[model samples]
Target: MESNPAGQGPALSGNVMFYKKPEPLSPEAHGSLGVKRIDQPLGFLRSAHAVPVTVSEFGMAAASFPVIFVGNDKTPVAVMGIREGQNLFVGADGNSDQDFYLPAFVRRYPFVFASDNQSDRLLLCVDREGPMVTDQPEVPFFENGQPTKFTNDAIEFCKEFERQRRATMEFVKLVDSYGLFEQKSVNFTPRDQNGQEGPQQKIADYWAVSEEKLNQLPADKFQELRDNGAIGAIYAHILSLLNWQRVIQRALRTPPPGQPLS
Candidate 1:
């Protein structure tokens, strides 16, 4: 078996490499919000596009609120909107007299929606996927634009979705901080060992062991292990999970409460 200078092996069979062509990075990529670029800021409101019928169906009525549409290099990733005044609230029947504050993150993408009407400003962050959603609880949703009541389980799912989104963002920041993808050279030789294969083989063995260990732990435990200086032992395992994508999708979905799809 041949080995690269870094002691890494050649492409293995059944290995699928998904490479995202580096986008033309902007200074915002390294901005305060983490690995995201805000090409535009809050300004003149654009003409309203087709509003999802689900908004009214869910009995979410708000006039002239700010909606932020988050996306990646592709299509719209998530939509978050916030409204103010005494009439905006999240009630069982989607009718109330309380001001509503809604912050959401798409589970499958690195996006977040933070809105406060008192401040009259909506803050949008990108590439900051985190565990905004998880297995703890469920959030309600409007079905077919009808104010049908949903179980707490539904609401919990929505919450978990956001939790997962934030978690993904944090994970990306962690990897970037390590500069793991930055190109570097490493040396490995079979002859270097006592008549054994080179560093590549050693790395492969280590990865195999690490993977097994990671698979056995639950999500929370796995994260704890990583926080406790077991990162290298579980890097490959966590990366394989692609947990970021899950959070992104969830964030993109229309959230419960009387908030519009911003």
Candidate 2:
């Protein structure tokens, strides 16, 4: 989540990461606005080191980047870099450095669902500040005051995302109830030109699913998790931790400010 840029309509609940100006979509407010392809559409991601991920993305994302749980909510996030405001995977051109799984959260950018507490319904909103959104146009949001196919498709994608988000919340609650989380730290030991190890630097501290605790659970409880289809996601999280070394290697290649390199 970042600072709320001045806008109209109901404010989005929870953390609205990467969104600067989110306004409710409407023919009156944004009929002229449309999305257009650009060279660096995802360039905004360069400053984001971690992005939220749904449970469904665990296995796919695990193979690409380290997925870790964070905050009191135990929100799942894919770690992209060891340092703040540094995304190792996103190059200066805003494209991924290599082929990898892109989180749905990132893909659903610009369009998001905001809860309307009063109406007890979800409202589709667009980030008026999104790079792709423009008035000059390519794919118009609306035609003849009705939402165009592009807008309708975006709505469907956002709806599915919301479903996954709710499921992720339930998964977090289940894991928390079982007391399966533990505090973990990421540390990196840099090397000098001679290949000698330097002092280890602490990179981040976050909550993670504890394999020990998980294994120690009663057989019945373990089976319950399995029956509930949570076992796969849990193991996926554990396996993803192994990729921390991969992230460290990337950091070394393009070391962050203040970090020494070999």
Candidate 3:
């Protein structure tokens, strides 16, 4: 696709995770750049313990991992692991377990949409430093000075991701308006071979939708939520909290260094 040469267009600021050098896609700057297929395409996820998930992904993500709301924006994130710099779901070979649902956010690695503050346009940018990106052969980003089929596909995927992101924001606002969010924590207690419990250790602290508050909402308000088709995702989030133990179990299977495995 046609684009402003590297030095032009609005600069992408802010600290985006995983993207070290995200530059706007343009034939002039990246005509020779393309991605090479790698054995471990998902290796980047190895360091990501929590990944953002949109409302539409809640049901699918809930089935695989705990979905928790976090921060002032109440961004929904799937808990992939209990510790920092570790993802239990992602294997050393950069492959996730079979039959587990992977979030779209994780699947859209190396490509992201950044808004141009000068105008109401979103730019499709790629992580120039990404491992899969290269100056050599494979899938070409541009052909005959225009974006190729691969680039077009990435643009479409990024576009859909942006739509889902906005929808997720609205869902969060709706949940907040009803005062259904509550502070919560995940704790783990170690047990000896004899099954003797040790001190409870707090693994993480975050926010969650309160099932009691949701149940106590006025009939009209509850019906409104149902009509909006948000009730299922809300219930999914609550139910997904039960999977925190599953994450803990996974963590126990792959304990951190210096710790004995149970």
Candidate 4:
């Protein structure tokens, strides 16, 4: 249960996190767009190593993926792939298991609730690189220079996601204030000359909730955590570590590690 404080976790890539080519959805730019509601595969997601997830997702995400924290912000993320630029959940055919609980972060792709520092409003942005974004025909983003029903719905979904994101941030701050996080690293090794396990090699390090620190919380503070429903999430995170073995096993069947990624 002992841990070493690694100061901060690595930064997550903005590219892999969903806002790949974010552009404010505007009539001027998307006036002629007809984004159809069709069944399309997210083969592109194969390149994403991790995706930002909400606190609400901890329980469900832990069921399939190892939910971890990253960056100085301590953003909750679900590890989709063990190696860099490889998402094991996404098959070469570009489809994910339909039965698995898809994180809201992936579902909200191609659309983002962007903050405009100049104003207190959230701007709805769309990924210009989205495969579905086109000028031809099934769903129009605007009608008579006004947002269409589909576009409006997307806006509402983004707003809801933003609200969830805020609450998630609060949860992160709560955990941080409790001094329960520590830098953790996982190691792996190949067999040696006599078929014995070789030296363990560190592969990844990230911020995670420390079970020891968690157990050391003041009595009243611990009660407050339970009252606020954070106690369950803390345990869920600890339990999710079991999934890392599954993730590593998946990496063995895939392509060799390519480029190094943060």
Candidate 5:
């Protein structure tokens, strides 16, 4: 059998030469390539004869198109754009089914997109296994989202997800120990009957006192707290403080301190 070139595929018949774009183009341009639109929630675009494209290249064009869903069953997947920067984020959906992002096995694979505008496409293929779609009712979405589903029975997707969550919590606590969430405040409260305020009350009475005391705690102690569950709580507290800080800062910057807020 005759072999196709490394990057080039089989040639076309007649005087016409098959030319694949070096990158994926906008969905609107799909018509030019004879690609048909599949009416799915994810908004996938399909073409029978088109070649597969690389993720990076495909992403550039996919990002340009407003359609959130695009892909073919021959390549069961969805390509969507993430607003983080300019690059498009590609995802996979199964057989017109929902819950694409919940697959844990999918995370093991590095996403790929079409890299060229020509019909020839590039894709980053990973050997990692994926989850098999089962008849089980789709996992319910709730307060604590369901763990990623893995199609491959060989890998435990839930375990990996938990590990990542724990690592993230640890990092958050480390950041909170630096007093990054501390705030200044003024308030009036009564002291003890003996006219002597308790250390707890004093700390609350003077924001500077609390700040100084927190600062005195050894860095090692803070690290230890992070080793415990203190980090997650601290992270949550710091985020809350950050939001309050922004609100107060905006109020102070505006015309009147007490002016009816905008």
Candidate 6:
């Protein structure tokens, strides 16, 4: 989930990788705001550096992106590109590459669940800048001064997402409790004309479960992690690191915003 540009901090409880202009959805302010369904609802995501993901998406998303953790609390994020302001998955035509798993974070765009820190209540929000948002939505958000089916569905989706987020938080806390997570980083190098490897370039840094520490856990702790389904997600993340090379290849084939493709 993207965060409010007002610097209210992370857009989502766990991750705030892509949110830029989040505004609370209100009946009075957005009464006429309707979202127009477009074939390319994700065009704006072309510029996203990275996106949040649910624990359920670990396996599928890991197959396509480098799943890593961010922030002091260790929020998990799918590495989309090796550089900032770039996303190799989005083509120059501004369309997400076909046949790829779409993370729930992006799929829930335009509408999101925001927490009112003071009230400790969850509120529905919309990205005023979202490309899918419009005054001419095929489905209106409000009808006769009341929320329509579209708004209702969005609320349901957001509510479910927030619930999943809480579950993910517990999982992260579980990993942290065991002290199994370690800071992770990667490097890249290109071969020179003569086949000599160039200077190693650092790609990105994040946290991940340490395989050694994970393996060294006590029986009870290990079982706890297993019962909670953290083991699979941890290994999935470890395996996804191999796909870093795959992302490198894609970056070479189609570069992101700042870095050009080879």
Against the reference, the lDDT scores of all candidates come to 0.27, 0.87, 0.88, 0.75, 0.28, 0.77
Candidate with maximal lDDT? 3
lDDT, candidate 6, at 134: 85
Instruction: State the lDDT of candidate 4 residue by residue for 1-262, as single tens digits.
Output: 0111222212222343645676667776677885755464576577787878888788988888888898889888888886678788886667887756688878877887665554445567778778777788588888887888988888788788888899899999999998899999886664433557656666578899999999988899999999988999889989988988887766655554463221
What tens-digit string does per-residue lDDT give for candidate 3 at 80-139?
Answer: 998788889988888998778899897787888876777767788889989999999499
What TM-score, to 2 decimals, does candidate 4 have? 0.83
Q: In candidate 2, what are the lDDT values of residues 139-167, reduced to their tens digit? A: 99989978889889999999999999999
lDDT (0-100) at residue 45 of candidate 3? Answer: 86
Sorted by lDDT (best first), the order is 3, 2, 6, 4, 5, 1
Query: Relative to the unseen true structure, what is the C-alpha lDDT of residue 57 in candidate 6, on a scale of 0 to 100?
Result: 82
| Top candidate, metric TM-score | 3
Expressed as tens digits, the lDDT of each residue in 141-167 for candidate 5 is 111221222222212332354354445
Q: Give the TM-score of candidate 2.
A: 0.91
TM-score each candidate. Answer: 0.22, 0.91, 0.94, 0.83, 0.20, 0.85
Which candidate do you rate higher for lDDT, 2 or 6? 2
After superposition, candidate 3 runs with Cα above 4 Å error: 191-197, 257-262
Clashing residue pair totals per candidate (backbone < 3 A): 49, 0, 1, 0, 33, 3
**What tens-digit string does per-residue lDDT give for candidate 1 at 130-182?**
22212221321223332223322333444565464445445434433443322
What candidate 5 gets wrong by more than 4 Å, as runs, is: 1-87, 91-155, 180-262
Q: Which of 3 and 4 is the better model by lDDT? A: 3
Candidate 2 RMSD computed on C-alpha atoms after optimal superposition onto the true structure: 3.8
lDDT of 2: 0.87
lDDT of candidate 5 vs native?
0.28
